[model samples]
Target: MSKKNKNALGGARQILDMNAFDAGAEATERNPLLERRLANVGAATVLFYKEPLEIVSASGSWMTAADGKRYLDFYNNVPSVGHTHPRVVAAVTDQIARLNINTRYLNSVVDLYLDALKATFPAPLSNVVLSCSGSEANDLAVRIAAAASGGTGIIVSENAYHGNTSIISEISPSALKRGNLPDHVVTVPAPSHPGQSGSIENAFAADVKRAIAELERRGHKFSAFVCDSIFSSDGVYADPPGFLRKAISEVRKAGGLYIADEVQPGFARTGDAFWGFARHDVTPDIVTMGKPMGNGFPMAGLVTRPELLERFCEDTGYFSTFGGNPVAAAAGMAVLDVIADEQLQSNALRQGNHIQERLRDLATKDDRIADVRGAGLFLGIELSQPGEKDQPNAELASSVINGLKDRGVLIGAAGRFGNTLKVRPPLSLSQDEADIFVDRLADALAASA
Candidate 1:
């Protein structure tokens, strides 16, 4: 943590007299919505609502919750742009106030939306289909994949989380609840540092080979190898891009389409490239995007080769009532425009580098930190158990998250072990805000230690 950040945090606290508000473990004891939402997530009592500090409004990299508290939000990766960015808000408001309609009726917004979207992809994937959420997009992708290959079998990573939709859950290993296993889906271990002897790339490649062998033995062909570009739910394994590339190659050779789930790592969140799969130097057969594209307006889409889309359409009509509503298209357009005009991608590069360096420094100082990994703003700090070499420390990660919250920063965790501190703030985050987050995290780690 830098001295300047320490002073800024201190000044902010002093100005608000932050201690006066009940910003602690029991802060949400009185708020019904906070309490209900907590219980709804099955993480009851895992969080608290701060009051007297309720958020009233916000712009750029900040957020005002409901109780007057201003949070330097670092957990909202879905809002690819900063919160309430004027450009986005203006576009949506203007469009809604003027004319908001669905895709059934042709509109200028739809044309503008698709034109802007085409620039983001390679030549082959030029067709577009819109949905209201990433889950729907994934569901549609599954249907398209199955239809294209004439197979029902699909393969996914062990801890991969595509979406909450039922058909997608049938293939998502991360959706492993009691009595919730789906048929016809082959599961494979995600790429990770395997047992200290192999790199994540080696483990991933080996797993891909084994999976393909099993498919052959079973005498079944797969339709798709669907996976997130950055497996956020598995862990921050950003290295070895060609690892997935190799796996996709094998799957394609076996007559399956390569599907890249870019819900969490798209919109230039990764520093090296705009799309996470680009880092692998692989062009996917189908690329679906959502979450960050509309800055939380609930718009998702899939881009694929023109011929493949035509084949899928031959069987059934693909349609969604509110998928590409004018309002959503406007919001999506605004996000892209802001990303380009503001150069948030460059900001992500600069801040992500600083964040990785700082986390690595902290990892050196603390043995509990087993690994610090990721690309661009989508980074993770994995904590280790006391006597384990590679086991994840879920409890310690939870403590760090709560402790940071107590100190005025909000973050989330990921990975199968639940031991990774996920840090993905809005793209508008400034260096000053990053410095504040780093300080809070360092302090939280030290206190927990």
Candidate 2:
């Protein structure tokens, strides 16, 4: 084949082999359930593992598969509190039985939930707009920013995955399957420090400033700079507190609003702060939250300054039929109660520190384990080729992820090169659970080796 054809085939192979769970595994047997799912579900639906685990039930930090085996979950951040906490279950059940209605009517439950949610944010972020999912919240945030700033340009990380909405997908460079970024959207490199020295903060700020200038050159006025506060999809970079201050300032100076997408790192998962942006001490103009909002309930929302919200409302009247319904409010409230009552945040801090300490020790012995960095429970372990530091070894990462699954532990990968193990577990993970995770991770590394 010609060189160009060979390169095209290599690219196709890379995409096909991107599944972290398919490495070092035997050929999948034909399962009847798998066949049924394939027939019904779209081709875009991705499943974990070459042989997918049929998870039947879950609790706390463990899930029971159809094979009657329990796996320690380190992949799911959606269950922020835990998998089906009794309080959340009871709250949803009770609210459904009592009354479930939209926010159009006067509802005491919604009011109480709103009050509790607002208390978590800074005073200026008093206005809230509830939505059904992170995608909707992000979509609305973009709209609000555009309306408030009268600008159409947006800035995002190179591999950011903000949401799945059409507008959001355009800005989410990771979601773009083909073609360059849209004219109105510009992407900056994620805040990552591999080998390059100097301040990552200043570097990031410079990138933001350049993106804003480029947007202006193209006659697209800057509207917003949106990012996953923890840089989750860009491989979970949460270090050097206050690193984001410079970039946020650049966005504000460029007359663009800062929208913090807290879908992955919110709700005390970071342990250091309730929201990931809080760790950087940067107050976003609009904060979009989801995934862990209701401890797995289909709930998300955006918190913003009252003036911006008022301007958005004036531009386009906003109403969500099922956004802040009584049931969702009840579930959200229950999640908050569980977070405080169970002291999950403190537990996350303690366990996360322990895990990172153990992993750092392991890294000293393992050449392939390039870097172990994160804040609280949101962590990433970068894999590299043996003896070649900083050279991402995506194949090794895939092998380790699949190996962990075979050993009854669940995990995933992230980053532009897909070589960073994304280790985000439930906030309620116990010390014992952390020990299990570290042990399994060590074994998985060995297996990969």
Candidate 3:
């Protein structure tokens, strides 16, 4: 949509580059912390905003900067249960104080957490392998799929971002700042945004069929079709429930597994279901989840059919030093407890619908907001040129993001074109907070305009 926005989506996932600090730009302020941070992290530093907020602490849906300014936290993919949730914090603190050992030990907390977690999954996905991050979970899931299916080819959405590990990065087209995808990886278009009338179920399934054929021709036997149920990196496409059924059916017909990477959409974030894939009513052969499992604790994992794990372990065993530890298990259990005890899933649905209605009302008044679509708290606001709804306006999206920041609200961008504002507030977000976001977004749009 732009020669100017070429840098936004050309390489490196837009989530990384969008609204990222321009290290090359001249700074008018002399900040000691910024200088020290840059010196420490060097080129690897990925700070948000040109002027980067110095966040010192966070709680619930707000983050406090070093300057004592509080900003609504909407951009972070982690902290799904909310930043610094007390239950998760207390659970981790207490468990670590008593015992924090690897899963090799027979810890009741670990078993209790596993049993409770497994109960949430479909019956066949009874086995769970714990890891330290979503990337690790995805890496293991892919290997399991390949081992079980006896193939190497994997299909993903064009801009899908599963994780940062070698295997996952190869399939994550958005992660690459340069170079083509590996031969074993193939990509299909994301499901269309809601409100675009068509048989979306069939269109997406057809694309998977094409990807499968291409992989076959490349000598990479189709092993799996992997994607986050919400397609978070593909601009958060969540609509027309059950659209994934046909695609998974096609993958199964070709003897390929359907791997659901739920790092972003699981843990009641989608509101309607315990797992994002459940909203589509399709059972994933392998499900990879992280980010929100232990709230902020470093714990992630994959659940799959017992046979898949059994087959994989025959070749090589798997273990993570800190994964499934008593402390992590405690945190995990607390997160699960909070979700159930607080009725957060129902709250997510209510608030999400509330915000969506407000955004749609704004869309009527402002043509720049091309569309407002997504489920629960995982919403996307697509920006376009006024009177030209299809024309992506990344510059506008960036401007609005910064503008929102200045207005004390925080958000991020997504989409292949980097024109969609990712409105990912915490599932525990209240109606009052929801209104603040929408009201400020309108102000930001007007100010940016």
Candidate 4:
């Protein structure tokens, strides 16, 4: 509930600020490799912690740094089934040894994988297009929306982050570094309220309507209203199931397609549902997924109605050099099998609830803990001034993040002001790992105080 600060840190820049790193004079002197990394890695690379942990190996929910210290990981979600899962590894290895090529040839593996992937979606979302990353998937979704709706205008959340492609970057407000949004794009506030008065949904929908009107005023036809279902970059707003229904309806009324960006909350990470949009009881015209889809393997895709796919293809045929390759298919299939056999969805729900309950108890003792909100394994803890709950405490968030790293735990921050702690561990995290994170977080809070 904090008021917006104009000068606050925004977007991925906050994640890359040099002040957030822990490379002290002594630590830097001991590790010449840090200088080597700086020399080789691009300036755009975003590393975690003040003194970056040189992670050497990982397994399950734990990772070992070069210092011979093992830290409990509470940040990474890409390894949904868990880090270095034997089944996923074996699948990729076997496929690599047999065959690995583009989708041009008649491949049974790709066919079988496509069937398994489609089985995860609703009946109408029968067509699939494979890509190599979430950015590529989103880029394609935007093109499809423009083709299907014959509109160039796109709407997104205030701090939404879709991808890195040029077209997608124009639609992603979080990726914008200067001036107002591009002429063809507009934004609406995310649904962040807990629905104390049951007005949050209506207010959000109204915002969407206003944005649509503004776009029309500027002589741009509405194309799509894309959103990350959990609103991760807008500070994790997954509450009051069906809150997104009204906004989606508004988009449809405006003759715009609803593109659900499931890069963050897909593949059973949300506990009760496989897709974040499902929690709202609505079906999007296009669904794009990435990150955890291949369990660390490079794979992403979009699923949409067959009509939309056909319309898009009629304009310009699509083909990806590395998309849906045999190895990627093997990895994707293995990830699905692991999720089903291991019952990760149920585990996500149980552990997420337990962690939230523990954090709520901590909130009772610490006034700085302004709010705790999220679903399943993806959650956020909002920090604010002790007396003024409307003033975000980014300094405290930064301190806590660094303190946790010092105590052998890893996490990150998100939101417009970088005041919300983002906790999205792998779905395979154990109850004991959750307890460890809670304890470490408690210690980090104390240290920050």
Q: Which candidate's TM-score is highest? A: 3
Listed in order, each prediction's TM-score against the native is 0.88, 0.94, 0.96, 0.95
* lDDT values for all models: 0.79, 0.87, 0.89, 0.87
Stretches off by above 4 angstroms in model 1 are 1-28, 34-56, 194-199, 386-389
Spell out the clash pairs found in candidate 4.
21-49, 21-50, 22-50, 22-51, 23-50
Check candidate 2 and list the clashing pairs. none
Collision count for each candidate, in order = 11, 0, 2, 5
What candidate 3 gets wrong by more than 4 Å, as runs, is 1-13, 193-198
Considering only N, C-alpha and C atoms within 3 Å, which residue pairs clash in candidate 3?
12-176, 12-177
- Candidate 3 lDDT over 1-449, as tens digits, reads 35555554343355589779978899989889989999999998999998999899999999999989999988875887789999998999998899888878798999999999999999999999999999999999999998999999999999988888888889888878878999999999889832233588988988899999999999999999998899887778898899999989999999999999989999998899989999999999999999989888889999999999999999988989988889988999999999999899999899999999999999999999998888988999999889788677888998999999999998999988788999888788999999999999999999877
Mind giving the per-residue lDDT tens digits that candidate 2 earns over 249-355? 99998899999999999999999999999999989999999999998889999999999998988869988899999999999999999999999999889899999
lDDT, candidate 4, 121-195, per-residue tens:
889999999989999999999999999999999999988889989998887776665667789998988787534
TM-score-based ranking? 3, 4, 2, 1
Return the lDDT, model 4, position 64: 95
lDDT score for residue 401 of model 2: 85
Candidate 2: Cα lDDT at 129 = 90
